[model samples]
Target: MPPGDAYDAVIVGGGHNGLVAAAYLARAGRSVLVLERRDQVGGAAVSSRPFPGVDVRLSRYSYLVSLLPPVIVRDLGLRLTLAKRAVSSYTPVVRAGRPTGLLVHRAEPERTRASFARLTGSDREYAAWRRFYGMTGRLARRVFPTLTEPLPTRAALRAEVADGAAWEALVERPLGEAIEAAFADDLVRGVVLTDALIGTFTHAHDPALRQNRCFLYHVIGGGTGDWDVPVGGMGALTDALALAARQAGAYLATGRTATAIATDGSSAEVTYRDAVGEHTAGARQVLVNASPDRLAELLGEPVPRPAAEGAQLKVNMVLRRLPRLRDPAADPREAFAGTFHVAEGYRELDLAHRQAAAGRCPKAPPSEIYCHSLTDPTILGSEAAGQGLHTLTLFGLHTPARLFAADHDAVKAELLSATLARLDAHLAEPIADCLAVDAEGRPCVEAKSPVDLERELWLPGGSIFHGDLVFPWAEEEPGESGPERWGVATGHPNVLLCGAGAVRGGGVSGVAGHNAAMAALGR
Candidate 1:
């Protein structure tokens, strides 16, 4: 902890990515130090018992894991366990003034087909759904393995897929155009497009095709892109990473904020602040696991900011029991076990995006909910489960950061009220009625806006991806070598970016961290 201590590598921002990098570097026999500003090291992936007198530990910010690679899991020997949901999604759609549900079962294709038939009155849409996901599944298999290796050129990537038509439909065309052409029903189309829009605010047909990049990452994760729940909540994963890093001889210092980073000809320096005083550390190389904007600020340089804006409202609630669905035939346990879409049909999502872009909240906010407790009851323990307690995590789309820039508190309240009302539309009773009260008798609900995310997690503009997602592979160039092909390299010789802001970065995937370590190792 001395001011002039030197290490082989120094990592700023001890989020999961930073920890991953630290673990890998330390395991390679390099002296590593990780400095985290927060009291805890998890960043957004931490789990906490927010409600008083409640024994529930909720995955506060980032809930599901779809991107953490198995290679990283095996490399670190992490003890984290991920549980898959039996139901992929259960969206409630109103038919003839009576609510009906569209259940996408992971294990039972026939059941999913039946649900689609009942809702759309046809099996054609279900067949299309299979074909579309099948294409993504193939792409996932071809692409996911290459992530840990050096980046490939776009042409090389396409050649690997070997399916020109499928690539053109998914990678070249606008995702919105493809979705519309593939499905006839609005409900099914919305469900497919939702993957593209999560934490991203963009139209399906955006010529820039930002949504396409987002969608690609969503489905290509884990080779099949199934979002699994952490058995002990997200904290368990972070804790395991931290443990791995520490056991590998990496020095992790919490409550220490890196204020500035400067590089000389051969080495780098990191100036940080702690409770007692300021200190400076030296390293042969520096790995930045922070947002690009934050990195620029630390380096005292100006860089064109990415078109990054977080457009979602996150609300975490511990309910006494699952809310009853309006559909009489649907079981609340089954429906809430997977993602529950609320007012998120194709037309509704498009309208919400248009309204938000025009600087107005949609009349009916579109959102998706998940019951984490249903998948992993261990989060609540026997005391809470005996009382029939559950957790409902709702993510409201089209609630952009700009909307809350002027009056953050007031706008957040208004957005939360509207979002809950939208969810209540499909429920037989108000969601508030199933609330679990704290010792103070307050409702067990906590809502976070983009501003809150920016303030707490240092996510620039509250963008969960750190920036607009870019195509994973490198663009073709005349001459590029190993380090040049990697996305983690900064302009500085000894400085690297290992955060979500890097290309092929986002989600809970530690690919950036892995890439950064390999770059530093001259691989």
Candidate 2:
């Protein structure tokens, strides 16, 4: 940890991606140094006890793991465990003052089909659902492996997809058009569309095709897109990565903020601030695991900012007991175990998007909730579990960045109230009633706005994806290298991106980190 120490490579952030890059490079016998600004290294992937004196540990920011390639897990020999949910999703539909809902059972397709029939009034919608996902499943298998290897050209990727109908439905047309055409019921259509809108603020019919990119990433993870909960929370995964990197001879230094990065053709210089003072480190190459906007600022360059506004509200709460659903036939445990959709029907989602786009909070906010303790109770220790405590994480959609720009506190409170009211509509009892109070007697409810995410996580515009998602394939330009190259390339020869801003980068996947290391190695 001495000043003027030269290394083979220097990583600017110690998030999962940066750690992954450092592990790979150092394992290959490169002297790598990872500089992390925060005291801890997991970035948004860490778990912590949010409520004071509460034994419950919640996955504070990024919750699930789906996009992480299995190859990286096997290659790194990580001991991370992910548990699958029994149910895929359940969407509540209120009719005639009664609770009727559609449940997509992961283990029991028959039950799911029955629920679909009861809610949509036919078996045809279930058949269509199978067909649509079947195509995506095939597309996922064909395309996901290519993500870690090299970027394929747009034409090459289309040839790999190899289905004209799928190409037209998923790639050519807006996602809304495809969903509407495929499903008969509005609720079913909305359920299908929710995957495309996660963290992305665009509508189903957005001409820019941002939703299409989002949908593609959501469905293609490990060729199945099953978002599984970490056994001991997300921190377990990153902690393992950090250990692997250190074991591979990577130097990990926390509380070091990278201030600037200057690169020439062959080498790079990184200026950073530690507790003591400013210092400089030299490396043959630099891997930046920060947002594109942050990187631009570090390099003292001006670039047009992408439309990367995050448009969701995250609320994490610990409940004393499970709330009862209005549906008499539905089991509350099964319904809450998976994704529970509230007021997220097609029309409701559309209206919320329109309202948020017009700078007003929707009257009826759309959201989805899931109980993590149902899948893995280990997060709630013996003490909390003995008290019948469970963790509920709610993600409210269409609560865009612009709404919180002027008055973040006011907008966050207003949005949380509206969103909770929307959830209460489907519950037999108010959600607030099933509360677990902290030592101070405050309700165990914490909400994070986009502004808060920006301030804490260094996410530009609070975007979880880093920027507007690009098409996962390569766009070949004149005088450029072959399409089969890593997407982590930067303007400088010795600098690359190892974060969410890289192409084919989003979610908790370490593909960007792996690709950045491979690019650095000239593989």
Candidate 3:
């Protein structure tokens, strides 16, 4: 390549990580070009009007983002408007007079625990809830960085060595066991454990699944780990990142899909096709924002060994009015801005998992519903415009795509109907009645199973974590390579692995992008 024409780096996929990597690299004085397959730059972190006047936040696969480090937010001066409203959750338990449900919100821990103690009458269990989340917050801060770097620095290494035992105890234990050790109430256990297994297919009894819970604990809300949305919607954060990336001197193209990555030892050649025609660029370094499996598909054959197995993700929604519970006395506030878990109890949740494993969507699926409109009213425009419709994101993981028939209409209706049925079980009326609208965001919701998310996101084996978050994978060395062992550095002269699909596993955190840029530019 001609010296004048060579770029220091070319980032593929204009997702947040790609934009972030471009910004960091350019800031470090590297000539950077960002190539996006889609016309829009946000990838999954985008908002588009699928229907007129219906602005849907197409958080495609991800809806929450507290895992994103504050450092990137500050360094890029990314101003984010988080939903100030607190998270509310309710689990219904019917009594003679009326149905009662446990409600938790922005309250003093003492008060929250007192409520729990009243319900379960276990002081020890209440204390455990407080301490567990407190520890989870601390642990997220400590472990989040591990997935970013190719290897830890001397300072980091020394710290890890010092805290080795504590780390093991925290990450290695089964999330269910960990919860059991901490809380006695089955209801409390069900709530806490449900989150641990949120985006994962793992049951509560599954080992290392608790680590997922630990990760989730940090992803939603901080402080005591409450879940919140951006003031306008989650898309606000992505918009800020894109604005920052453009300000830092990076080009963005939407709707242009990347076709192949040709690496010739020293540099990478990125080939993409858009409406115009095929275009290719040569860069000193290359970063991918796609899932590992998607990357492999784009590259075609001779696939790179995957870092993660990939995650199965599903979203169901269309809302006319907000879902009303069967119990009229239930707190309306708790029904909004918070997550609703239909798992009910451990046994039911476990059964749902079994059904999912059997290549069928569970009858009463274990769901985590997040009503975005209630929390961020700005998304719906002005109240004078009309009653803002609510959008609920239901995540189902571990189920393979085969559950749905290849027919698009059949599969969509099936999943949609099934999801509503589960909600109706608890609510007196069908949740679907509230629907002023509904839509499926899964790229191929009808034909493809949730497991197809692995291929769709282009990560290996559909492992969302890119691989297990176990020791070696979490603390990968610079030149290492193996199953569950991270080798974020491609060992090529300029290519750097920059997505959670690389080696750090998955999350909304931007460390993968930051570290990749640092490595490419020798920062």
Off by over 4 Å in 2: 2-4, 477-484
TM-score of each: 0.98, 0.98, 0.84
| Clash totals in order | 0, 0, 38
Task: List per-candidate RMSD values in Å.
Answer: 1.3, 1.5, 4.6
Clashing pairs in 2: none
Model 2, residue 224: distance off in Å is 1.0
C-alpha displacement of 313 in model 3, angstroms?
5.1
For residues 1-523, write the lDDT of model 2, one tens digit per residue: 5434898999999999999999999999999999999999988898899898789989998988999999999989998999999999988888766788999999999998999888877899999999999989888888899989878888888898899788888988998888988887888989999999989998999999989999999999888978899898888888999999999999999999999999886888999999999989999999999888888888889854655688889999999999998888788899999999988889888999999999999899888999999999999989999999999999888988999978889889999999998888888999999979998899999998888888988888888888888878876731243112788877777888899999888899999999999988877
lDDT of 1 by residue, 105-214 (tens): 99798999999999988899999999999989999999999888888889999999998977887889899888988999998999999998999999899988888998
Cα lDDT listed for each candidate: 0.90, 0.89, 0.60
Off by over 4 Å in 1: 2-4, 477-482
Worst lDDT run of 10 residues, candidate 2, spans 475-484
Q: Global lDDT for candidate 3? A: 0.60
Per-residue accuracy of model 3 over 395-460 as CA lDDT, tens digit each:
654443445436634654676666657667777677656655423422212222344554454435
lDDT of 1 at 419: 91
Task: Provide the global lDDT of candidate 1 against the true structure.
Answer: 0.90
| lDDT: the better of candidates 1 and 3 | 1
